[model samples]
Target: MSIQILNLNPCYDHWVIISKPPKTPNVLRGDYVVKLVDGKGLNIARVFNTLGFKDYICINILGGDVGKIIHAKCKEDGINTLEFWIEDESRINTAVVYEYEKRMLMVNEPGPVMQRKEVENFLEFFSSVLKENGTLVVSGSAPRGFGIKDMARIARFAKEKSCRLMIDISGEWLKELLNFEPEMVKVNADELRIALDLQQMNLGELLHIKDSYNIKVLCVTYGKDGSVTLLDNRAIRVKPRVIQSDYSVGSGDSFFAGYLYYEALNKSIQERLIFATACGTANTLKYGAAIFDLQDLESQLSNVDIMEEEL
Candidate 1:
Protein backbone atom coordinates (compact mmCIF):
# COMPACT_ATOMS: atom_id res chain seq x y z
CA MET A 1 0.00 0.00 0.00
CA SER A 2 1.18 3.51 -0.82
CA ILE A 3 1.05 6.70 1.27
CA GLN A 4 -0.51 9.85 -0.17
CA ILE A 5 -0.30 13.34 1.34
CA LEU A 6 -2.66 16.17 0.37
CA ASN A 7 -1.72 19.73 1.24
CA LEU A 8 -3.93 22.43 -0.26
CA ASN A 9 -2.23 25.55 1.09
CA PRO A 10 1.50 25.15 0.57
CA CYS A 11 3.76 28.20 0.90
CA TYR A 12 7.30 29.54 0.93
CA ASP A 13 8.39 30.08 4.54
CA HIS A 14 10.87 32.85 5.32
CA TRP A 15 12.54 32.61 8.73
CA VAL A 16 14.33 35.50 10.36
CA ILE A 17 16.80 35.07 13.19
CA ILE A 18 17.43 37.43 16.07
CA SER A 19 19.70 37.34 19.10
CA LYS A 20 16.99 37.52 21.76
CA PRO A 21 13.27 37.52 22.27
CA PRO A 22 11.37 40.53 20.98
CA LYS A 23 9.75 43.07 23.27
CA THR A 24 6.79 45.24 22.40
CA PRO A 25 7.67 48.55 20.74
CA ASN A 26 11.34 47.59 20.43
CA VAL A 27 13.45 47.67 17.30
CA LEU A 28 15.06 44.38 16.27
CA ARG A 29 17.51 43.56 13.54
CA GLY A 30 17.45 40.20 11.81
CA ASP A 31 20.79 38.46 12.07
CA TYR A 32 20.09 36.27 9.04
CA VAL A 33 17.35 34.67 6.94
CA VAL A 34 16.45 31.11 5.96
CA LYS A 35 13.83 30.17 3.42
CA LEU A 36 12.16 26.81 2.73
CA VAL A 37 9.18 25.14 1.12
CA ASP A 38 6.85 24.57 4.05
CA GLY A 39 3.39 23.07 4.46
CA LYS A 40 2.09 20.30 6.69
CA GLY A 41 1.99 17.74 3.87
CA LEU A 42 5.32 18.86 2.46
CA ASN A 43 6.89 18.55 5.89
CA ILE A 44 5.56 15.01 6.25
CA ALA A 45 6.95 14.14 2.82
CA ARG A 46 10.30 15.65 3.81
CA VAL A 47 10.43 13.47 6.91
CA PHE A 48 9.58 10.40 4.83
CA ASN A 49 12.33 11.24 2.35
CA THR A 50 14.82 11.92 5.15
CA LEU A 51 14.04 8.48 6.55
CA GLY A 52 14.74 7.05 3.06
CA PHE A 53 11.09 6.01 2.56
CA LYS A 54 10.29 6.90 -1.05
CA ASP A 55 6.99 5.03 -1.41
CA TYR A 56 4.78 8.08 -0.87
CA ILE A 57 3.36 10.86 -3.03
CA CYS A 58 3.08 14.56 -2.14
CA ILE A 59 0.12 16.41 -3.62
CA ASN A 60 -0.39 20.22 -3.75
CA ILE A 61 -1.62 23.17 -5.74
CA LEU A 62 0.97 25.49 -7.30
CA GLY A 63 0.73 28.95 -8.84
CA GLY A 64 2.75 32.09 -9.60
CA ASP A 65 6.43 32.66 -8.74
CA VAL A 66 6.27 31.29 -5.18
CA GLY A 67 4.64 28.11 -6.50
CA LYS A 68 7.32 27.75 -9.16
CA ILE A 69 10.04 27.98 -6.54
CA ILE A 70 8.31 25.43 -4.33
CA HIS A 71 7.97 23.06 -7.31
CA ALA A 72 11.66 23.43 -8.12
CA LYS A 73 12.63 22.89 -4.49
CA CYS A 74 10.61 19.68 -4.35
CA LYS A 75 12.44 18.43 -7.43
CA GLU A 76 15.77 19.41 -5.90
CA ASP A 77 14.87 17.47 -2.77
CA GLY A 78 13.77 14.51 -4.92
CA ILE A 79 10.23 14.54 -3.49
CA ASN A 80 7.60 13.15 -5.85
CA THR A 81 4.59 15.46 -6.23
CA LEU A 82 1.22 15.40 -8.00
CA GLU A 83 0.76 19.06 -8.88
CA PHE A 84 -2.29 21.09 -9.86
CA TRP A 85 -1.87 24.57 -11.33
CA ILE A 86 -4.10 27.46 -10.32
CA GLU A 87 -4.55 31.14 -11.19
CA ASP A 88 -3.95 32.79 -7.81
CA GLU A 89 -0.48 33.36 -6.44
CA SER A 90 0.70 31.02 -3.70
CA ARG A 91 1.31 32.36 -0.17
CA ILE A 92 4.47 33.46 1.62
CA ASN A 93 4.77 32.92 5.40
CA THR A 94 7.20 34.60 7.80
CA ALA A 95 8.56 33.51 11.17
CA VAL A 96 10.91 35.25 13.57
CA VAL A 97 13.02 33.02 15.85
CA TYR A 98 15.44 34.07 18.56
CA GLU A 99 18.89 32.70 19.15
CA TYR A 100 18.73 32.96 22.93
CA GLU A 101 15.09 31.94 23.34
CA LYS A 102 13.47 28.83 21.94
CA ARG A 103 10.25 30.49 20.78
CA MET A 104 9.16 31.89 17.43
CA LEU A 105 6.58 34.38 16.12
CA MET A 106 4.86 33.33 12.91
CA VAL A 107 2.79 35.20 10.33
CA ASN A 108 0.96 32.92 7.87
CA GLU A 109 -0.99 33.77 4.74
CA PRO A 110 -4.35 32.19 3.77
CA GLY A 111 -2.95 31.05 0.37
CA PRO A 112 -4.48 31.14 -3.08
CA VAL A 113 -8.18 30.68 -3.80
CA MET A 114 -9.04 27.78 -6.07
CA GLN A 115 -11.31 28.16 -9.04
CA ARG A 116 -14.21 25.77 -9.75
CA LYS A 117 -12.41 24.05 -12.58
CA GLU A 118 -9.24 23.74 -10.51
CA VAL A 119 -11.08 21.95 -7.71
CA GLU A 120 -12.88 19.58 -10.08
CA ASN A 121 -9.71 18.77 -11.96
CA PHE A 122 -7.96 17.99 -8.67
CA LEU A 123 -10.70 15.60 -7.58
CA GLU A 124 -10.38 13.75 -10.85
CA PHE A 125 -6.63 13.47 -10.51
CA PHE A 126 -6.95 12.52 -6.84
CA SER A 127 -9.34 9.69 -7.63
CA SER A 128 -6.96 8.33 -10.22
CA VAL A 129 -4.06 7.96 -7.75
CA LEU A 130 -5.95 6.40 -4.81
CA LYS A 131 -5.54 2.63 -4.31
CA GLU A 132 -7.28 0.03 -2.21
CA ASN A 133 -6.11 -0.09 1.41
CA GLY A 134 -3.55 2.68 0.80
CA THR A 135 -3.01 5.51 3.30
CA LEU A 136 -4.35 8.97 2.46
CA VAL A 137 -3.15 11.80 4.68
CA VAL A 138 -4.99 15.12 4.58
CA SER A 139 -3.11 17.90 6.33
CA GLY A 140 -2.85 21.70 6.52
CA SER A 141 -5.56 24.25 5.75
CA ALA A 142 -7.90 24.49 2.82
CA PRO A 143 -7.73 27.34 0.34
CA ARG A 144 -10.27 30.18 0.67
CA GLY A 145 -12.67 28.87 -1.96
CA PHE A 146 -12.59 25.28 -0.64
CA GLY A 147 -14.94 24.75 2.27
CA ILE A 148 -16.50 21.91 4.26
CA LYS A 149 -18.31 20.53 1.25
CA ASP A 150 -15.10 20.24 -0.67
CA MET A 151 -13.43 18.49 2.23
CA ALA A 152 -16.32 16.09 2.66
CA ARG A 153 -16.05 15.14 -0.98
CA ILE A 154 -12.45 14.16 -0.47
CA ALA A 155 -13.37 12.07 2.54
CA ARG A 156 -16.12 10.32 0.64
CA PHE A 157 -13.75 9.54 -2.18
CA ALA A 158 -11.30 7.98 0.27
CA LYS A 159 -14.06 5.87 1.77
CA GLU A 160 -15.12 4.65 -1.66
CA LYS A 161 -11.54 3.83 -2.58
CA SER A 162 -11.15 1.67 0.55
CA CYS A 163 -8.20 3.70 1.78
CA ARG A 164 -7.09 4.37 5.33
CA LEU A 165 -7.76 8.05 5.97
CA MET A 166 -5.28 9.81 8.25
CA ILE A 167 -5.57 13.47 9.13
CA ASP A 168 -3.72 16.26 11.01
CA ILE A 169 -6.09 19.18 10.88
CA SER A 170 -8.16 21.04 13.46
CA GLY A 171 -11.02 23.51 13.94
CA GLU A 172 -14.27 23.23 11.98
CA TRP A 173 -12.72 21.09 9.30
CA LEU A 174 -11.75 18.45 11.84
CA LYS A 175 -15.07 18.61 13.67
CA GLU A 176 -16.91 17.93 10.41
CA LEU A 177 -14.68 15.15 9.07
CA LEU A 178 -14.89 13.00 12.19
CA ASN A 179 -18.30 11.90 10.98
CA PHE A 180 -16.59 10.13 8.10
CA GLU A 181 -14.81 7.79 10.55
CA PRO A 182 -11.18 8.30 9.65
CA GLU A 183 -8.89 5.34 10.39
CA MET A 184 -6.28 7.47 12.14
CA VAL A 185 -5.89 11.04 13.36
CA LYS A 186 -3.21 13.11 15.13
CA VAL A 187 -3.85 16.41 16.84
CA ASN A 188 -2.40 18.47 19.66
CA ALA A 189 -4.29 18.39 22.96
CA ASP A 190 -5.39 21.98 22.61
CA GLU A 191 -6.60 21.38 19.07
CA LEU A 192 -8.60 18.39 20.26
CA ARG A 193 -10.25 20.40 23.04
CA ILE A 194 -11.13 23.20 20.67
CA ALA A 195 -12.38 20.83 17.99
CA LEU A 196 -14.65 18.99 20.43
CA ASP A 197 -15.69 22.21 22.23
CA LEU A 198 -14.94 20.44 25.51
CA GLN A 199 -14.33 22.25 28.77
CA GLN A 200 -11.99 19.53 30.04
CA MET A 201 -9.65 17.09 28.26
CA ASN A 202 -8.14 13.91 29.60
CA LEU A 203 -7.20 10.39 28.47
CA GLY A 204 -10.61 8.99 29.35
CA GLU A 205 -12.35 11.80 27.53
CA LEU A 206 -10.16 11.19 24.52
CA LEU A 207 -11.16 7.52 24.37
CA HIS A 208 -14.83 8.43 24.75
CA ILE A 209 -14.61 10.78 21.80
CA LYS A 210 -12.63 8.32 19.76
CA ASP A 211 -15.24 5.62 20.22
CA SER A 212 -18.06 8.03 19.48
CA TYR A 213 -16.48 8.70 16.09
CA ASN A 214 -15.49 5.04 15.55
CA ILE A 215 -11.94 6.09 14.80
CA LYS A 216 -9.47 3.20 14.89
CA VAL A 217 -6.46 5.15 16.13
CA LEU A 218 -6.36 8.53 17.91
CA CYS A 219 -3.11 10.24 18.92
CA VAL A 220 -2.98 13.39 21.03
CA THR A 221 0.31 15.21 21.57
CA TYR A 222 1.10 17.47 24.55
CA GLY A 223 4.24 19.11 23.26
CA LYS A 224 7.07 18.74 25.78
CA ASP A 225 4.80 17.07 28.34
CA GLY A 226 4.48 14.00 26.10
CA SER A 227 1.64 12.25 24.20
CA VAL A 228 -1.18 9.71 24.60
CA THR A 229 -2.38 7.26 21.99
CA LEU A 230 -5.56 5.17 21.80
CA LEU A 231 -5.22 2.11 19.60
CA ASP A 232 -6.91 -1.31 19.55
CA ASN A 233 -8.80 -0.47 22.74
CA ARG A 234 -5.58 0.34 24.58
CA ALA A 235 -4.41 3.66 25.98
CA ILE A 236 -0.64 4.06 25.63
CA ARG A 237 1.31 6.96 27.11
CA VAL A 238 4.75 8.11 26.01
CA LYS A 239 7.28 10.45 27.65
CA PRO A 240 10.12 11.74 25.51
CA ARG A 241 13.64 12.69 26.59
CA VAL A 242 13.83 16.33 27.60
CA ILE A 243 15.56 18.50 25.03
CA GLN A 244 16.41 22.10 25.87
CA SER A 245 15.64 23.59 22.47
CA ASP A 246 12.33 24.77 21.02
CA TYR A 247 12.21 25.57 17.28
CA SER A 248 9.00 23.49 17.37
CA VAL A 249 7.33 24.79 14.24
CA GLY A 250 6.88 21.46 12.47
CA SER A 251 7.42 19.10 15.39
CA GLY A 252 3.82 17.91 15.38
CA ASP A 253 4.00 17.14 11.68
CA SER A 254 7.23 15.29 12.27
CA PHE A 255 5.58 13.25 14.97
CA PHE A 256 2.73 12.35 12.65
CA ALA A 257 5.18 11.37 9.94
CA GLY A 258 7.10 9.20 12.37
CA TYR A 259 4.00 7.31 13.41
CA LEU A 260 2.99 6.78 9.80
CA TYR A 261 6.51 5.68 8.94
CA TYR A 262 6.47 3.02 11.63
CA GLU A 263 2.97 2.00 10.63
CA ALA A 264 4.25 1.47 7.11
CA LEU A 265 6.84 -0.84 8.63
CA ASN A 266 4.12 -2.81 10.46
CA LYS A 267 5.46 -1.87 13.89
CA SER A 268 3.41 -2.30 17.04
CA ILE A 269 1.52 0.59 18.63
CA GLN A 270 4.00 0.98 21.50
CA GLU A 271 6.96 1.05 19.13
CA ARG A 272 5.15 3.55 16.92
CA LEU A 273 4.56 5.93 19.80
CA ILE A 274 8.19 5.71 20.92
CA PHE A 275 9.49 6.48 17.45
CA ALA A 276 6.93 9.26 17.02
CA THR A 277 7.96 10.97 20.24
CA ALA A 278 11.62 10.53 19.35
CA CYS A 279 11.09 12.16 15.98
CA GLY A 280 9.33 15.08 17.68
CA THR A 281 12.13 15.52 20.22
CA ALA A 282 14.78 15.25 17.52
CA ASN A 283 13.12 18.10 15.59
CA THR A 284 13.85 20.45 18.54
CA LEU A 285 17.58 20.08 17.90
CA LYS A 286 17.30 21.74 14.52
CA TYR A 287 16.65 25.36 13.49
CA GLY A 288 14.72 24.48 10.33
CA ALA A 289 11.20 23.13 10.58
CA ALA A 290 10.85 19.31 10.39
CA ILE A 291 14.58 18.84 9.76
CA PHE A 292 16.36 16.20 11.91
CA ASP A 293 19.49 14.13 11.62
CA LEU A 294 19.03 10.41 11.05
CA GLN A 295 21.62 9.68 13.71
CA ASP A 296 19.83 12.01 16.09
CA LEU A 297 16.59 10.12 15.52
CA GLU A 298 18.31 6.78 16.10
CA SER A 299 19.91 8.07 19.31
CA GLN A 300 16.62 9.43 20.57
CA LEU A 301 14.88 6.07 20.22
CA SER A 302 16.48 4.85 23.44
CA ASN A 303 15.45 7.99 25.36
CA VAL A 304 11.70 7.45 24.96
CA ASP A 305 9.56 5.68 27.57
CA ILE A 306 6.25 4.01 26.81
CA MET A 307 3.60 2.31 28.97
CA GLU A 308 0.02 1.14 28.67
CA GLU A 309 -2.54 2.67 31.01
CA GLU A 310 -5.99 1.42 31.87
CA LEU A 311 -8.73 3.61 30.51
Candidate 2:
Protein backbone atom coordinates (compact mmCIF):
# COMPACT_ATOMS: atom_id res chain seq x y z
CA MET A 1 0.00 0.00 0.00
CA SER A 2 1.09 3.54 -0.67
CA ILE A 3 1.52 5.31 2.68
CA GLN A 4 2.42 8.88 3.60
CA ILE A 5 2.73 10.57 7.00
CA LEU A 6 2.01 14.28 7.39
CA ASN A 7 3.48 16.57 10.04
CA LEU A 8 2.68 20.23 9.46
CA ASN A 9 5.44 21.46 11.78
CA PRO A 10 8.84 19.79 11.87
CA CYS A 11 11.61 20.46 14.40
CA TYR A 12 15.08 19.71 15.69
CA ASP A 13 14.76 17.66 18.91
CA HIS A 14 17.57 17.65 21.44
CA TRP A 15 17.65 15.23 24.36
CA VAL A 16 19.78 15.32 27.48
CA ILE A 17 20.09 12.66 30.13
CA ILE A 18 20.82 13.83 33.67
CA SER A 19 20.64 12.39 37.16
CA LYS A 20 17.92 14.73 38.32
CA PRO A 21 16.21 18.02 37.81
CA PRO A 22 18.38 21.07 38.24
CA LYS A 23 18.07 23.20 41.34
CA THR A 24 18.48 26.99 41.32
CA PRO A 25 22.04 28.25 41.13
CA ASN A 26 23.27 24.78 40.27
CA VAL A 27 25.79 23.89 37.62
CA LEU A 28 24.34 20.68 36.16
CA ARG A 29 25.99 18.24 33.79
CA GLY A 30 24.29 15.92 31.38
CA ASP A 31 25.32 12.24 31.27
CA TYR A 32 24.52 11.97 27.59
CA VAL A 33 23.11 13.94 24.71
CA VAL A 34 21.28 12.91 21.52
CA LYS A 35 19.72 14.94 18.78
CA LEU A 36 17.47 14.18 15.83
CA VAL A 37 14.76 15.46 13.53
CA ASP A 38 11.52 14.77 15.34
CA GLY A 39 7.82 15.44 15.00
CA LYS A 40 4.80 13.22 15.46
CA GLY A 41 4.85 12.28 11.79
CA LEU A 42 8.57 11.70 11.76
CA ASN A 43 8.37 9.64 14.91
CA ILE A 44 5.76 7.43 13.30
CA ALA A 45 7.92 7.14 10.21
CA ARG A 46 10.94 6.23 12.30
CA VAL A 47 9.06 3.49 14.09
CA PHE A 48 7.74 2.17 10.82
CA ASN A 49 11.24 2.05 9.43
CA THR A 50 12.42 0.24 12.54
CA LEU A 51 9.68 -2.30 11.93
CA GLY A 52 11.06 -2.82 8.38
CA PHE A 53 8.58 -0.67 6.49
CA LYS A 54 10.66 1.84 4.58
CA ASP A 55 8.53 2.76 1.60
CA TYR A 56 6.53 5.51 3.29
CA ILE A 57 7.42 9.20 3.06
CA CYS A 58 7.16 11.96 5.66
CA ILE A 59 5.58 15.25 4.55
CA ASN A 60 6.16 18.54 6.44
CA ILE A 61 6.94 22.25 6.16
CA LEU A 62 10.41 23.25 7.34
CA GLY A 63 12.36 26.51 7.38
CA GLY A 64 15.61 28.34 8.16
CA ASP A 65 18.84 26.98 9.68
CA VAL A 66 17.02 24.70 12.10
CA GLY A 67 15.08 23.31 9.19
CA LYS A 68 18.31 22.67 7.35
CA ILE A 69 19.64 20.78 10.35
CA ILE A 70 16.42 18.78 10.55
CA HIS A 71 16.67 17.88 6.89
CA ALA A 72 20.29 16.80 7.22
CA LYS A 73 19.55 14.69 10.29
CA CYS A 74 16.60 13.00 8.64
CA LYS A 75 18.76 12.17 5.66
CA GLU A 76 21.32 10.62 8.00
CA ASP A 77 18.57 8.55 9.58
CA GLY A 78 17.42 7.43 6.11
CA ILE A 79 13.95 8.97 6.40
CA ASN A 80 12.40 9.95 3.11
CA THR A 81 10.88 13.40 3.32
CA LEU A 82 8.93 15.74 1.05
CA GLU A 83 9.58 19.16 2.51
CA PHE A 84 7.96 22.53 1.87
CA TRP A 85 10.66 25.08 2.58
CA ILE A 86 9.76 28.45 4.18
CA GLU A 87 11.68 31.54 5.26
CA ASP A 88 10.66 31.41 8.93
CA GLU A 89 12.95 29.26 11.06
CA SER A 90 11.75 25.88 12.16
CA ARG A 91 11.41 24.99 15.85
CA ILE A 92 13.91 23.50 18.28
CA ASN A 93 12.68 21.45 21.24
CA THR A 94 14.50 20.04 24.23
CA ALA A 95 13.77 17.18 26.61
CA VAL A 96 15.59 16.33 29.82
CA VAL A 97 15.39 12.68 30.78
CA TYR A 98 16.27 11.71 34.31
CA GLU A 99 18.38 8.71 35.25
CA TYR A 100 16.89 8.19 38.70
CA GLU A 101 13.35 9.23 37.90
CA LYS A 102 10.83 7.89 35.40
CA ARG A 103 9.87 11.33 34.14
CA MET A 104 11.07 13.91 31.66
CA LEU A 105 10.77 17.69 31.36
CA MET A 106 10.22 19.07 27.88
CA VAL A 107 10.10 22.52 26.33
CA ASN A 108 8.79 22.95 22.80
CA GLU A 109 8.93 25.94 20.48
CA PRO A 110 5.99 26.94 18.34
CA GLY A 111 6.77 26.39 14.67
CA PRO A 112 7.22 28.93 11.89
CA VAL A 113 4.45 30.96 10.33
CA MET A 114 3.62 30.56 6.63
CA GLN A 115 2.37 33.15 4.21
CA ARG A 116 -0.91 32.65 2.32
CA LYS A 117 0.98 31.78 -0.83
CA GLU A 118 3.11 29.24 0.97
CA VAL A 119 0.00 27.54 2.29
CA GLU A 120 -1.53 27.49 -1.16
CA ASN A 121 1.65 26.13 -2.67
CA PHE A 122 1.81 23.38 -0.05
CA LEU A 123 -1.80 22.36 -0.71
CA GLU A 124 -1.07 22.23 -4.42
CA PHE A 125 1.99 20.11 -3.86
CA PHE A 126 0.10 17.77 -1.57
CA SER A 127 -2.60 17.39 -4.19
CA SER A 128 -0.09 16.65 -6.91
CA VAL A 129 1.54 13.82 -4.93
CA LEU A 130 -1.58 12.11 -3.63
CA LYS A 131 -2.17 8.63 -5.04
CA GLU A 132 -5.45 6.81 -5.39
CA ASN A 133 -5.98 3.98 -2.83
CA GLY A 134 -3.03 5.31 -0.81
CA THR A 135 -3.05 5.76 2.95
CA LEU A 136 -2.55 9.25 4.37
CA VAL A 137 -1.79 9.54 8.07
CA VAL A 138 -2.00 13.10 9.42
CA SER A 139 -0.29 13.62 12.76
CA GLY A 140 0.77 16.53 15.00
CA SER A 141 -0.37 20.17 15.24
CA ALA A 142 -0.29 22.78 12.52
CA PRO A 143 2.10 25.71 12.42
CA ARG A 144 1.09 29.38 12.69
CA GLY A 145 -0.91 30.71 9.67
CA PHE A 146 -2.56 27.31 9.37
CA GLY A 147 -6.08 26.78 10.63
CA ILE A 148 -8.74 24.09 11.03
CA LYS A 149 -10.26 25.01 7.68
CA ASP A 150 -6.98 24.41 5.93
CA MET A 151 -6.64 21.04 7.66
CA ALA A 152 -10.18 20.06 6.68
CA ARG A 153 -9.42 20.84 3.10
CA ILE A 154 -6.60 18.32 3.07
CA ALA A 155 -8.96 15.66 4.39
CA ARG A 156 -11.58 16.52 1.79
CA PHE A 157 -9.04 16.31 -1.02
CA ALA A 158 -7.64 13.03 0.32
CA LYS A 159 -11.11 11.54 0.24
CA GLU A 160 -11.60 12.86 -3.23
CA LYS A 161 -8.44 11.07 -4.29
CA SER A 162 -9.67 7.79 -2.75
CA CYS A 163 -7.07 7.73 -0.01
CA ARG A 164 -7.67 6.07 3.32
CA LEU A 165 -7.32 8.64 6.09
CA MET A 166 -5.99 8.07 9.61
CA ILE A 167 -5.35 10.87 12.07
CA ASP A 168 -3.53 11.33 15.38
CA ILE A 169 -4.27 14.92 16.28
CA SER A 170 -6.37 16.77 18.83
CA GLY A 171 -8.22 19.95 19.86
CA GLU A 172 -9.91 22.13 17.27
CA TRP A 173 -7.89 20.57 14.44
CA LEU A 174 -9.22 17.13 15.33
CA LYS A 175 -12.71 18.45 15.94
CA GLU A 176 -12.73 19.86 12.43
CA LEU A 177 -11.27 16.73 10.79
CA LEU A 178 -14.11 14.61 12.18
CA ASN A 179 -16.46 16.10 9.63
CA PHE A 180 -14.31 14.54 6.91
CA GLU A 181 -14.92 11.08 8.43
CA PRO A 182 -11.54 9.46 8.57
CA GLU A 183 -11.29 5.67 8.55
CA MET A 184 -9.26 5.39 11.74
CA VAL A 185 -8.92 7.93 14.59
CA LYS A 186 -6.35 7.63 17.38
CA VAL A 187 -6.14 10.02 20.30
CA ASN A 188 -5.39 9.96 23.97
CA ALA A 189 -8.27 9.99 26.46
CA ASP A 190 -7.71 13.63 27.37
CA GLU A 191 -7.59 14.73 23.72
CA LEU A 192 -10.81 12.86 23.00
CA ARG A 193 -12.57 14.58 25.89
CA ILE A 194 -11.31 18.00 24.88
CA ALA A 195 -11.98 17.57 21.16
CA LEU A 196 -15.56 16.44 21.74
CA ASP A 197 -16.03 18.66 24.80
CA LEU A 198 -17.01 15.75 26.98
CA GLN A 199 -17.10 15.99 30.74
CA GLN A 200 -16.51 12.27 31.01
CA MET A 201 -15.83 9.46 28.52
CA ASN A 202 -17.84 6.27 28.58
CA LEU A 203 -18.68 3.48 26.16
CA GLY A 204 -22.08 4.85 25.28
CA GLU A 205 -20.74 8.29 24.52
CA LEU A 206 -17.87 6.85 22.50
CA LEU A 207 -20.31 4.76 20.52
CA HIS A 208 -22.60 7.73 19.94
CA ILE A 209 -19.77 9.91 18.68
CA LYS A 210 -18.23 7.20 16.51
CA ASP A 211 -21.57 6.37 14.95
CA SER A 212 -22.35 10.01 14.36
CA TYR A 213 -19.06 10.54 12.58
CA ASN A 214 -19.20 7.20 10.79
CA ILE A 215 -15.75 6.44 12.11
CA LYS A 216 -14.88 2.79 11.52
CA VAL A 217 -12.15 2.46 14.12
CA LEU A 218 -11.90 4.73 17.17
CA CYS A 219 -8.98 4.18 19.54
CA VAL A 220 -8.58 6.13 22.76
CA THR A 221 -5.26 5.54 24.45
CA TYR A 222 -5.31 5.80 28.27
CA GLY A 223 -1.53 5.81 28.71
CA LYS A 224 -0.36 3.22 31.26
CA ASP A 225 -3.93 2.00 31.58
CA GLY A 226 -3.75 0.81 27.94
CA SER A 227 -6.37 1.75 25.35
CA VAL A 228 -10.11 1.37 24.78
CA THR A 229 -11.13 0.88 21.17
CA LEU A 230 -14.37 0.63 19.21
CA LEU A 231 -13.77 -1.58 16.18
CA ASP A 232 -15.95 -3.81 14.04
CA ASN A 233 -18.92 -2.99 16.28
CA ARG A 234 -17.09 -4.28 19.35
CA ALA A 235 -15.48 -2.60 22.31
CA ILE A 236 -11.96 -3.81 23.14
CA ARG A 237 -9.93 -2.89 26.19
CA VAL A 238 -6.19 -3.44 25.89
CA LYS A 239 -4.00 -3.76 28.95
CA PRO A 240 -0.38 -3.17 28.08
CA ARG A 241 2.62 -4.96 29.46
CA VAL A 242 4.31 -2.78 32.04
CA ILE A 243 8.07 -2.49 31.70
CA GLN A 244 10.77 -0.78 33.75
CA SER A 245 10.94 2.75 32.39
CA ASP A 246 9.66 6.28 32.90
CA TYR A 247 10.13 7.73 29.43
CA SER A 248 7.12 7.60 27.07
CA VAL A 249 7.67 10.53 24.77
CA GLY A 250 6.74 9.00 21.41
CA SER A 251 4.78 5.94 22.52
CA GLY A 252 1.59 7.18 20.90
CA ASP A 253 3.28 7.68 17.58
CA SER A 254 4.85 4.25 17.85
CA PHE A 255 1.44 2.79 18.56
CA PHE A 256 0.01 4.47 15.47
CA ALA A 257 2.85 3.19 13.34
CA GLY A 258 2.44 -0.32 14.66
CA TYR A 259 -1.26 -0.34 13.93
CA LEU A 260 -0.70 0.87 10.40
CA TYR A 261 2.01 -1.69 9.78
CA TYR A 262 -0.18 -4.57 10.93
CA GLU A 263 -3.21 -3.18 9.14
CA ALA A 264 -1.26 -3.08 5.90
CA LEU A 265 -0.45 -6.74 6.39
CA ASN A 266 -4.19 -7.41 6.84
CA LYS A 267 -3.84 -8.46 10.44
CA SER A 268 -6.89 -8.96 12.59
CA ILE A 269 -7.91 -6.25 15.06
CA GLN A 270 -6.91 -8.50 17.96
CA GLU A 271 -3.49 -8.94 16.42
CA ARG A 272 -3.19 -5.26 15.58
CA LEU A 273 -3.96 -4.07 19.12
CA ILE A 274 -1.51 -6.51 20.60
CA PHE A 275 1.29 -5.32 18.33
CA ALA A 276 0.33 -1.68 18.67
CA THR A 277 0.23 -1.81 22.47
CA ALA A 278 3.47 -3.72 22.52
CA CYS A 279 5.15 -1.17 20.26
CA GLY A 280 3.92 1.75 22.42
CA THR A 281 5.14 0.10 25.58
CA ALA A 282 8.39 -0.79 23.91
CA ASN A 283 9.14 2.89 23.23
CA THR A 284 9.27 3.48 27.02
CA LEU A 285 12.07 0.94 27.30
CA LYS A 286 14.54 3.51 26.02
CA TYR A 287 15.36 7.16 26.58
CA GLY A 288 15.09 8.24 22.95
CA ALA A 289 11.75 8.70 21.31
CA ALA A 290 10.50 5.89 19.04
CA ILE A 291 13.75 4.03 19.50
CA PHE A 292 13.21 0.41 20.47
CA ASP A 293 14.87 -2.91 19.78
CA LEU A 294 12.94 -5.47 17.80
CA GLN A 295 13.68 -7.98 20.54
CA ASP A 296 12.11 -5.68 23.12
CA LEU A 297 9.03 -5.31 20.97
CA GLU A 298 8.70 -9.05 20.56
CA SER A 299 9.10 -9.61 24.28
CA GLN A 300 6.26 -7.19 24.98
CA LEU A 301 3.79 -8.91 22.62
CA SER A 302 2.96 -11.98 24.71
CA ASN A 303 2.53 -9.86 27.82
CA VAL A 304 -0.09 -7.54 26.33
CA ASP A 305 -3.65 -8.61 27.14
CA ILE A 306 -6.83 -7.98 25.19
CA MET A 307 -10.34 -8.34 26.55
CA GLU A 308 -13.87 -7.62 25.50
CA GLU A 309 -15.11 -4.54 27.36
CA GLU A 310 -18.67 -3.59 28.27
CA LEU A 311 -20.36 -0.36 29.24
Among all candidates shown, the one with the greatest TM-score: 2
The superposed Cα distance between candidate 1 and the true structure at residue 73, in angstroms, equals: 0.6
Query: Which whole-number lDDT from 0 to 100 does residue 129 have in model 1?
Result: 76
TM-score of each model, in listed order: 0.94, 0.96
| Tens digits of per-residue lDDT for model 1, 1-311 | 59989988899898888976557557777888878889999999999998999999999888899899999988998988988888999999999886877568999988998888888887787788777788899998888888788899899989998888999999988988899999988988998898888876876688888999999999888998888889766899898866658678899999999999999999988888899898888888877778898998987888888889776
Query: What is each predicted model's overall lDDT from 0 to 1?
Result: 0.87, 0.89
Query: What lDDT tens digits, residue by residue, belong to model 2 across residues 63-123?
Result: 9999999999888988988888988999999997767776678999987999888888889
Off by over 4 Å in 2: 20-24, 309-311
After superposition on all C-alphas, the RMSD of every candidate to the true structure, in Å, is 2.1, 1.6
Clashes of each: 0, 0
- Candidate 2 residue pairs in clash (backbone atoms < 3 Å): none
Candidate 1 local distance difference test against the native: 0.87
> What is the lDDT, from 0 to 100, of the residue 188 in candidate 1?
87
